[model samples]
Target chain A: MEEQLIECDVLCVGGGIAGLMAAIRASELGANVVVAEKGNPHYSGCGRRGNDHFETWIPEVHGADKEKFIDELLKTAKGEILIGRDILRAQFGKAHEIVELWDEWGIPMRQKGKWEFAGHAFPGRMMTHIKYEGRFQKTVLVQQARKRGARIMDRIMVDELLRDGDRVIGAVGVHTREDTVFVFQAKAVILGTGKCSRLYQGLTPGMMFNDGHGGVQTGDGRAMAYRAGAELMNVEMPQRHIGPKYFAKFGQATWVGVLRDAEGKPVGPFVSEPDRRYGDIVMEVNKLAPEQYGERGRGPVYMDCTGISDKDAAYMRHWHIHEGNVSLVDHMDAEGIDPRKHPIEFSTYPLRGGGLIVANEKAETSLPGLYAAGDEAMGDISAAATFGWISGDTAVAYARTVEHGDVEVTRPIIAALESRIDELRGRGNGPDWEEANIALQQVMTDYAGKVRNEARLLQGLAHLRRLRQKVDTELMARNQHELGRCLEVHNLFDVGELTFHAALDRRESRGLHNRPDYPFKNPLLSQAHIVRMEGDRPVTDWRSY
Target chain B: MPPIINPDLCIKCDRCVNICTEDVFFGSKKHETPVITYPRECVHFNGCVDVCPVPGAIWLRYPMPSMIVYRTSSDYRAPPG
Candidate 1:
C-alpha cells in the first residue's frame, strides 16, 4: 500500500516517440515535466523498437510547396484525411527544425549539408517519408529529456485523468511491477499514450492475439480522454495493416522491400515498385495479396530479395543497424531464413481502428489543460514530433498560468482509484486479462472488421456491452503486472465499444470503414464523427473541417 | 519461440531482466540468471539480445509458424527454404 505523489508542471504519459519528444520540449521550455510510462521508456509504446523512415517535408529533394503537398496528400496518403490538413501543415513547418534538433542529438537523419530523401516521389512527394536509421530515436529522446531535467517514472500505467469541472489537471496510475500507487498532479497533462493496441485478429476465422504493436498500446489515453469528456475523432476508422504473419511487430517500414507471390511470380506493378516507396511494402502487399490470404486455403506470400545485388544487400543490412527491431535481423539469422537465399514470408495483422483524440494544431484535445500526441493525434511521425513539440510549448504556457494546489480535486479521485486496485487484488478467480482481451478482439474483428453491416454492428455492440460488464465485474488481476494488463484491456474494450458505436452510427462506407450494406459515400454523413462522453454515455457530433 | 540463455556465458548481470519491458522473464536474483517463466508471453522484440553484454549469451528461437512459408502442400509455387 505504498502511495507516491509526483507534482510537475507538465505530465507526459506513454513515453513513446511522441511522449519523449514532448517531455524534451516541455522540459526545454522550463517546465518541470514528469513522464509516466507503463513499461521501460526506452523500449515501450508503438515507437519503442525503432523506425527506419520518418515522414517529413524535404523540399529541396522533393519540391516542397504547401498547396501542392496538401493536394498530393488528398491524392496519395493513406485513408481519408478529411480534417488533417492543419496537422499536416504544423508538421510541414516544423520538419526542418525537428530534423535539425534530432541531428544535433546525434541521429543525423539528413546527410551532411543535404536533404537525402527516399520513398514516394510520384506526381511529387506527398510529404510522406524519408529513410533514416532511427533505431535509437526513443532512447536518444529519453536521454535528451533527462538531460533537460525531466523525471521519467517508468512502469507506472496511468489509468484515469484527474479533472476539475471540464478541465483535466492530472492523472492516476499504478505500478506495473510493485504495489505502488502514483498520483500525478500536474498543471497541464499531455496524453501521448499512442493509439489503440493491435487488437483485430486479422482475416482469421478464429482469434489470434499475436499482433501486438510494441509495448501494450491499448488506447489508454483516448479512453481516459473519452471518460473525461474529451471529444475523440476517427474512432471508427479500423486501422488495418498488412505485416509479416508470425513476426507481427508494428513498425516494419522498408523491411520487406519486394514481395513475390507463392509461385515465385513477382507481385509486379506495386506502387513501391515504381516509386521506390519501400515504406509502402505493407500497402503494396495488401493491394496484391490474394483475396483470401491468411485463411487456411490461401497461398503463402514472400518478400523476394534474391534479385538485389550483393552491394545493395550489404548496404541494406548496414542501414538496419540504426533502425529499431534490429533484433529481427538476429531472429532471422538464428532461424536460418536468409532474405537473399530464402524468400521471407509475410502476412497481415489488423487493429480494430484508431479512436484518436480530437486535437488541434497545438495538440489540444477538446478538454482544457489536456493534450494528445503520437498516433493518438493521428498524424505520421513527423506530425508526432511536431505535435509533441507544439503541445509542449502550449502546455507549458498553460501550466504557468494555473495555481499550484489542486488537492481538493485529486483527493476523492485517488481514493476511488485505490479502492479499485484493492478490489482487483482481493479477487481470487475470474477471467484473466488475456481471455477478456481475446474476447474483445474477436468481437471487433467478427462484427466491426473491414466489411460491416448494420445488423452485424448492432450485434457486436450488444456483445461489447455484455463484455464490458464482464470486464468491469469479473476481470481479475493477480499482481501488479496483471493489474497493468487488466487496466489496458479495460481501456481497449472502451475504445472498441466507441468504435462499434461509431461504425453503427456511420451508415455509409467511407475510407477505412467499408459498409457493403450502404455501398457509396453518403454526402449527409461526410463529416468526421466526433464522439464525446455525455453524462456517462458517448454521443457523436458531426464536425466538418 | 523463446530466448534460450547460455548459462555458461551468462554472468547473471540481470540486464535482460531489467531491460525487458514485456515482463517476459521473472525478476532476477543477485548472481542468479532470471527465469523465463512466461515463455509464451514473449512478443519477440529481443530487447534482451540487444542489451546483452556477453555475445551469444541470449538468442531467440522463432516458433514453427514463422518457418511455415507454405500454408498448404498443394501451393508449391515457392517452396520453403
Candidate 2:
C-alpha cells in the first residue's frame, strides 16, 4: 500500500456539519480546502440523521435578548454549561447570517417565511429553537461545499494529526475500504469531528453503528487534537439524555408529550412552555414526590400526548424524520398507537459526554495552526456551525501566512503513524475491536459511570492502562473497516483515559461529573478541566474558563 | 428485529447496499439481494426502504421492547396547552 501525500491550504478532518461549514467558508474565501470524511459526506457525522431544530438564538422570537440567550445556555442546560461568552456571543451575533445561509443552501428554516418556534414560552421567552426538516443537512452542505470547489474525500478515517514542531501541519488517515493511507499536508488543520459517545456504546452488539445524535462519534477528532499537543476542556463530564427505549435517539417528539407515572399522574412538565432542560422533569420524577404521586413511585415514565391537538400530534409525527428513529412512527402507525392517543415509554441514557472544551470566538485551539469546531471543540450545532464559519476565516488567514511543513519534519511523523497502522493489519487472532471496545466500556461504566469516587477512578485508570498495553500489542483487524474500528477503539482508550483522569481531578460533582465522595457542586472547584499531553504523558489541570 | 431484506422483491439494484446510512448490509455479488451482515448494527433509519425501488424489499421490524403498545385513553384530554 502506497502512502498518498495530499497538499492543501486547510485540511478539515471531518465532513460533518462543522467540517462542511468550514470547508464551504474556506473554499469560498479561495483557500484550497480538503475535507477527509470517515463516512460518505452525504450521510456522515452528527447532523447525518438531521435535527428538528438548530439551537440558535433568534431575535424575532426572543426580542433579541442577548443576555437572556447567553444566560439560558449557561444555566438552562441542567447545570452551568461552562461555555465561553465569546463562543455564545459569536453564535448569537451571527445567528441571522447563518440562518440565511442555511435557508439559501435549501434547508427550509422558514415555514411561510416564518420560523416556527418551539419549547420556549412566549411573554418573556429567552430562547427560540427554530424548527426545520434537517434530514438532508449533510447532503445540502456537501452540495454547497462541492459547488464551492472544496474536495470532500469520503471513507478516509483520519487516525492522527501530523505535527510540525508545535503546530499541526496536517493529518494521517486510512481508506476505510482500501489499503491506501492518506497523508494530508496542509498549512492549517480544522477539526470538526463531533463528540465521543460510542466509547460507551460501540461494544453494544445491538448498537454497533449509531450514537444518540450522530453516526460513528468515537471522540476521534478530540483524541487527534489532544495527541497533537492541543488542550481539551470540559470533557471530564459525559451527559445522560432522556429518550425512547431500544434505539439511541434524542429530540423530536420525545419532548412534545407530558410525562406520566404509573398512576396516570403528570411526572414531567407539559412542555407547552418554560420546559428548557426537560431532563430536570425526569430527575424530579426520580425523587420522593409523595405529594405529587401519593406514594414513592419512580421506575418507568411514559410521555402522554393525549391532550395535545391534532395539529401538534401531526407536527410531532411530521418531525419524526428518524433523527429519533423515524421508523418508530411506522411501528406506532402499524400498532394503531397514535402517540397523541398512546403514551410512549421514555427513559434517560448517557446522552452527551459533557464539557464544552475551549475554542475561542476565532475557533483557535492552543496549537497555532489547528482549530477545533463543533463537538470536537465546543458548543452545540449553532456554536459548531458558528465556530466552523469562523474557523474558515481564521484557518484561511493562518494558512495564507505559512507554507507547508518541510518534508524532513513530516517524514518521521508519517513513518511512526504508518508503522502503528501496519501493526494493526492482518493479525489473525487477538483482541478484536469489539473485545477491546467492550473491555474499555466495562471499565468505564464500572468506575466512571454516574457515581464516581477516587478509589474506583484510580482503579479504572490502572485497568485502562493494562487494556491499552493489551490493545497496543495484541489488537487485530481483519479488514480495512475493522482497521477503522480498531483505530476508533484506540481513540476510545485515549478519550476514556482522558475522561477518567478528568473525572478524578475534578473533586466535586457538577452537572454530569458526579463524584459521590464529594456529592455537591463545589464553588471552589467550579472550573473546567483542560487535558493535554506533557511530552508522552497526559495531564489534566483545573482552569478558570 | 433488524431490517430484513426480502429476496423475492429485491431487484439487485445494489441501492440498499451502497446507500444504507449505517452500512448495515454487505453488497451481495453472488445474488440480487444484499446480506444483512451487520444486522445488529441496524438502527432502522429506513434509508434502504426509501432507496429500494421495489416495495417490501426492505423493512425494519423493531424489537417488542422497543414497540410498546400502551394505548392512552382516546378521550383523556384535560391539560390545556
Candidate 3:
C-alpha cells in the first residue's frame, strides 16, 4: 500500500459539467486544482445522459423580447427562491461567457443558423452537437481539465470538509473501491455534488440504484454549509416535473417533448407546430382522457408519431444502440411497429427537481471560502444548463480570489472536525447506508409529493424531521464508504426541511410547486418566499424579482 | 423501412427527452406511454438508440433499396422536368 499526497489551490467536489467548468476556470487562472467525483466521471451525473443543448434566458431562444423569458422564469419561481431582477438578468447575460468558457475547453458548439429543435418555442440558441453521444460532452470537458493540469480523483466518496475555524480549508474523502481515506488540502473548497432527487421516494425509480441512488444529493452542500452557519433558502419548496408512471421507468427524457390536448389526442399540426408550454393543458387532458393517462386516469394524452419516417428511426436507433435505453425500443418491438413507420405513445408523471440552495453572485456562502455549485446552489438557475455553467464559472472565479494569506485558521475548527471524524468512526457498525437511504426516499415519495396538502406535508416534515435526528444519534458507518452515505442522508434530512417549510409557507400553487388544495396560481403569493435557518427557528421573508 | 425494437434490454429511462436536438420525441401523459411525434425531424444521427442505457431495447431496420432510391435528392431533381 502506498500513500499519495496531492495538494491544490482549489478543490472541486463534483466533476459534472459544473465541476469541470470550475476546474477549467481555476486552472486558467494559474491555480493548482483537484476535482474529486463520487462516481465515474464518464458514466455518472446528469451530464452523462442529457442533451448537450444549452438553455439560455436570451430573447433569441425565448422570443423576440427578453421580458417574456424573465417573466416565464419569475412565474416558474412562483414566490419561492430569489428572483431579483438584477441577479436574474445578470445570470442570463452571462450565458455567452459561459459558452465561450466551454468552447475554450475544446467542447465545440454546433453553429447552425435558424436552428430548430425539440422542447422550445423558438429556434434553439443552444450550441448543440447532435450527431454524437451525450457523454461525449462530458468526455471532452474532462479531457480539457486534464489538459489544463487539473488533477481528477474519480470514485472517491467525499464525506466531509476539513475546516479550520469557520473556514473550509479542505476535504476528507475515501476511495470507494480501495477504501483508502485521503485528506485533500486546498485554499478553497467548492461543493458541486449535484442534488438528491433520488431521495424523494418513488419519484426516482430508475435512478434509485446509481451509487447514491438519489440519496447522495439531499443537499450535502446545503447541510455542510448550514452547519458552518451559511444562509439556506427555499428549504420548504422542492420542484417536480411531469414524470413516468410505470415501474422503474427511466425514459422520461424523451417524452418531455410530446404535446397533446385534454383528450390525449395530438395537438394542432402534430409534427410541424412550434413547441409551447403544454403544462396548462395537463388539467384539460386529465379531464378529457382520464382512462389513458394513469392510475388517476385523468387527461392522459400522448404523442402520436405513428407516421414516423424511416430516417427518423435511424436517428433514434443510435440511442438504443449506444445507451441501451430499451423502454421505448422494446415497447415499439412488442407493438410490431417502428418509430420511423409509426408514432410512439407518450405521457407524464411527477418528478421533483430538488429545492434550490442560496448563494451570492460569486458562488460564496455566508461562510467564507465555502462555495456551492450544481443542483445544490441556488438563485434562479438550479435545474437549467445555463445556470449550471454560470455557477461553475462563478465558483471558479471566487476560488481564484482565495489566497493562502497570513490570516491564520482557528485551532478550534480543526479540533472540531477531528473530533467529529473520530466520533463518527466510533459509532455502532450496524446501520446499512443503502437501507436507510432507501427508507428516506419512500418517506418523501409517500408524503411530500406532487399533491401536497397541509396534512401530507406536515406528516412528511414531522417524520423526516425526527428521522434526521435519530440518524445522527443512532446511525453509524463501519467505514469511510458507509460514512459518506450517512452524511448524505443527514444532509437530506436538513434540506428536506427546507422543501417542506417552503411548501407550507406559500399557501398557493405555482409552476412546479403545485398544491391540490390551493389549485390555482395565487397572485397575492407572487412575492418570493425566502426562508433561512436564522438562529434555529426557520425564519421566512419575502422579496420580488 | 423495417421497424426496430429490443425489449428485454429496455429500462425506459428518459435520456431521449433530455437529448433530441430536434424535439422529435414527447414524454408520455399519465395513463398512456410517451410517443415520438416528428419522425421527419430526425436526422438519422442515432443519438436516441445510442444513448439508451439498455443495449437491445431499440431495434433498427435497414432502409429498403426501393424506398432509399425514391427519397434520394437525385431522383426528386429529375422529376421536376
Among the numbered candidates, top DockQ falls to 1
Worst 10 residues of 1 chain A by lDDT: A202-211
Give the Cα error of residue A174 in candidate 2, in Å.
0.3
| TM-scores of the models, in the order given | 0.91, 0.90, 0.69
Off by over 4 Å in 2: A72-77, A120-124, A201-210, A250-255, A269-297, A322-324, A351-357, B26-32, B63-81
The predicted structure with the larger DockQ, 1 or 2, is: 1
DockQ of each: 0.38, 0.33, 0.03
Top of the candidates by TM-score: 1
Model 1's TM-score against the true structure = 0.91
Per-model fnat list: 0.29, 0.38, 0.00
Show pairs that collide, candidate 1: A135-A322, A135-A323, A135-A324, A238-A353, A239-A353, A245-A347, B1-B61
Q: Write the per-residue lDDT of candidate 3 for residues A1-545, one digit (tens) a residue.
A: 12244567888888776677678777866778898887656544555543434445434545665556666655543234444575556566665456555555554443342333333232333321122134366777778889889898876666566666567777666664353556677778777777665556542343343221223445666666665566666555554433322322222333223344344344433234213222122322232232334556454344433344445445455444333244334444544555333333333333444454565555666566777766666422223334545544555565666655222243444445445555666886645555666667777767766678888889988888677766766777665545555666667666667677778877877755668888888786666566666667666677553
- Candidate 2, residues A1-545, lDDT tens digits: the string is 78898999999988888999999999999999999988777766667667766677777666656778777656545346576577678878886689889998898888779887654332243445677778778779989999999998977888888887887888888987778989888899898888786666432333545446644678888887787878888677776655554444434343456666655676645343223223124432332222224334554566666666777666666677724346667777777877665666655544345354467788888888999898777746777777888899899999989988864577777787678788889577898987898788778887888678999999989999999999999999887777888888988898888888888888888766778898888898766678889979878877776
Judge the docking of candidate 3 as incorrect, acceptable, medium or high.
incorrect
In the order shown, what is each candidate's alpha-carbon RMSD? 3.3, 4.6, 11.8
Task: Give the CA lDDT, 0 to 100, for residue A337 in model 3.
Answer: 51
Ranked by TM-score from best down, the candidates are 1, 2, 3
